[model samples]
Target: MKKRLLALCATFFVAFSVPAFAQGTVISIEPGDGVQEALQEALILAEPGSVIELAAGRYDFTGPLSLDIANITVRGAGMNETVLSFTNQTTGSEGLLITAGGARIESLAVEDTPGDGIKAKGVDTVTFKDVRVEWTRGPHAENGAYGLYPVESKNVLIDGCVVKGASDAGIYVGQSQQIIVRNSRAELNVAGIEIENSYFADVYDNVATHNTGGILVFDLPNLPQMGGHSVKVFRNTVVANDTPNFAPPGNVVATVPMGTGIMIMANREVEVFENDLSDNASTNILLVAYPRDYNDPTYNPLPRAVYVHDNKHGRAGFAPDKAVKDIIAPITGLPVPQVVWDGAVDGFWSAFFGPDAEDAIYIREPMGTTFANLQMVKDMILPWGASPDFDIDDYDGSVPSREPVSLPQDQ
Candidate 1:
């Protein structure tokens, strides 16, 4: 009888404990003022694939919170109920930095960091959901550079988040591939959302308002990543980006005109469609060539293979900025067409007769929206001036439509 009882107890222990062990570890952090310290220790001690649960409370963190483990999840009670305030942050470039791939950070609010609010670097299969990163002090030049910054990462999904008050861009995705930034809202920043030097990005169903510039798809020079391409911006509300440019002087976004919406600069295979652009003073939508000098030989200065169609615009291009007020408006006059391009290209040969001689800017604006191509000949002379081409029919050629971004192993 004793042997039978011991055997039964052994069987029960194996049945329950084995399954519990296979379910992975759960590190529950107690609610306390030393939340940062406790969380840091948990990160250091927790095994891979562990779930770190943060209780509902305000966690004041001074330094940065980092995750270097793969397949780890840092989840909070809720974005509003559990707060990570960095208002008095003394050290770190970001509120939370995740370097490990296959990690998920969700349901947390990170506020008032000195630099970027949440930055994930070189990570694959990372998901950021229900996260709110904001600057409580409002828009200023000293605000963080980006609210949710992801660079050089692949298979990234940023969903259902709200970000505000970035000196540069509220949601900046750079050099990343297979990125989907959807169901998000950004406001009161320099560039509400920017996809720079990235490929295969799908940005849709987002609200971008009250920013310096609404949405930007740019390819800048001199970086580890160059030549952004294959971007799709659709079904988003990019409106009234009238906030003053608070970006630091040396940054690329500083040159972005205020009250501009959906600026695409020097990228290829871009499609902008089914979006609502309204009340932007400078221009509702701009497709311009990169004017700055670049050292990168592989970088394409002119935007090629871009398709813009079926977008709705409202009352844009009313008040112009300094660049427009000084150069474009002097020749084109006020309400500088809803869509304008510098028409700067590779000499008259390409502009008139070359492989890309066809107007690269394809505008099928169904609302009978007029557009202007400066054509780099204002006052009939060359160099700085341009004769404006205000006919919408001239830019009628269409490029091949690109496929949507495809990623493997997505959640």
Candidate 2:
């Protein structure tokens, strides 16, 4: 698949001059004019290609602003110039929603929304430029849905944006193809950025931090279609974002890479390289096996065929338990020690592949063990920079009572 364009190219200049529709309409929403009135008027007068300009201030809408029009432009003075504050939107409403083709939103701020900050659905040729989507009301699982959500769409571009404080995810793309999300910041949300059930998508040069999991590429089961294939996650900074486990009791499974910085699950032929992921409470880099059957019904395990390479690990807090224990063989003729972690060499071509018994070293049929650069891998292995207490019975953190931690749903 051809890679989606990451940067705004000069080619757009050619397309920008195409004659616009609704030639006589110049709708302006300013501090003096009520935002609701401007929006109502824009809806009344807006044609296929109308431009509604907004001036700077905190403009609160009484309810959701649903744009069913096609090929319209809703722009603000500048990113910082005009602010549409939705702190008072008490209904479960989105700050801005577009349900059209060739729609564009630029230089605006949408925040404190009861639902997703900006939702664009079924829109082809949509572009969000220099926009900010945030949920500053505080991180509650019920509050933040998504900073920016593009679902079941095609030819979407989300660039130069900021998404934060989302209870669920900063930016979420689901059931979409030919998408591009670049030069964005996703932090302090449930899952920073998630791309699920998407094909031929490119997520590059983005910062994902201070969330439960940083970046996720996965395919969900039982969807109308099976997608999430051939994606690339590269050139991003994923850092210490593991707060307390928020996944509700009996709903989450504790894995070593539990609060992993980046997880590539159930996707085929994916490349993860050249990113700095560290200081997370769990494993810095993880290649997981799809959970077959687990205690949590909320998440389905589906990881397979991943290529993890070229990343750095950081400092450790404590020593994990390491003992050369016994193993048990499976009845289905599968070796017990399936997933292998080899930190002695580079991650790309390392010999410690999973589920093959010929690669076994000493202990045969071990139940499940974690090996890292820690001296314990041979004794009681822990990866470099990971605390021994990780995934163990004893775990503590900056905040402990956060519950119902759900990973960012990519689809």
Candidate 3:
């Protein structure tokens, strides 16, 4: 009887110990049949601070995956090793939609989504690291809109990510504050890395190449968040962005001219410095006003207090395209200036009152770096031929440097 009881106790101990060991803080998920269901279930049922470990394998998902739980991590073995393929996805928009705060998604590849890849919306303290979102078909109009998209989120950090073949913008952060996007590569997209309608952003150390437009800082009208200001774009390599715009009609990025290096529109207090801009056929840098008509009284259509300094420009503006080819290059001549700014200001009232001292375009560059201010508003009102201003000395002052954006995740 004693021996039998001891044996039973040993069996009980073994049975419970195996389960306890398996049910630890980390939830390991293997890729196989029913992977979608298993991942979705794990995302839904995971407790706070739980780590959902995705093993190194290809996961074939037929629908979108969402995580609504806060303070959970979804980590894969490696970006290239662990693949999440949504090629045949028939439901939902994004490949993965994260709606919860304190979410960290790292080391995974999302491929061939019809809509977007890995979108974090309305969350706080989100981090996307070492992830790759790619459309293997190359740049096409039917490709997804954005890759590594974080919108309406605060304290966002996107680091060491690669996004390719997006129809719209790759590595897009919209309506987010306190954002830092660094060490990323965006290629074969309409706009490589765009900071749209966001405040207090630092975009640096990224490679923006082979896209239609390399980097765009734009503030459009009629968004939940407006008044984009205090953005610093520095230390980026924006080069050879000569891809034709493949964005579908009626998209905002469709208006971006091909071969644009860095375009800024309708934002205030922006600083562009220490970038390597080379081989962009349209222009190295373009500063323009909002081209469309809008009824938003709260919106300011003119870019103000912009500072562009200390950038290395090479072989740009040789072959302009789109509206720049049709209108701007004709006035500014072939091989349009490396820096092109449409001299647009508030209104007719500004002709007499003059622009405020704070709302000025400042450029401090090397001696031979070319520039042109198209005087667009003046020509529209006066119409006495296209009198483009090629003198860079008129705009030679600096604005106060903005403080670097600090995110909680970087710490």
Superposed by TM-score, candidate 3 places the C-alpha of residue 190 at a distance from the truth, in angstroms, of: 0.7
TM-scores for all predictions? 0.90, 0.68, 0.93
Clashing pairs in 1: 376-386, 377-386, 377-387, 378-385, 378-386, 378-387
TM-score quality measure for candidate 1: 0.90
Deviation in Å, model 3, residue 120 alpha carbon: 0.8
Q: Please write out the lDDT profile of model 3 over residues 160-209, one tens digit for every residue.
A: 99999999999999998999999999999999999999999999999999
Q: Name the candidate that leads on TM-score.
A: 3
Please report, in order, the local distance difference test score of every candidate based on alpha carbons.
0.82, 0.57, 0.89
Model 1 agreement with the true structure over 106-193: per-residue lDDT tens digits: 8988999998998999998788889898898889999999999989999988889888899999999999999988999999999999
Report the Cα lDDT for residue 133, model 2.
81
Candidate 2: lDDT over CA atoms?
Answer: 0.57
- The worst-scoring run of ten residues by lDDT in candidate 1 lies at 8-17
Best by lDDT: 3
Q: What is the lDDT of residue 307 in candidate 2?
A: 45
Question: How close to the true structure is residue 117 of candidate 3, measured as C-alpha lDDT?
Answer: 93
**Per-residue C-alpha lDDT of model 2 across residues 105-223, encoded as one tens digit per residue:** 88888877877788888777677878888767555655647788888877778888888777666788888877778898887777788887777677778988777677877666666
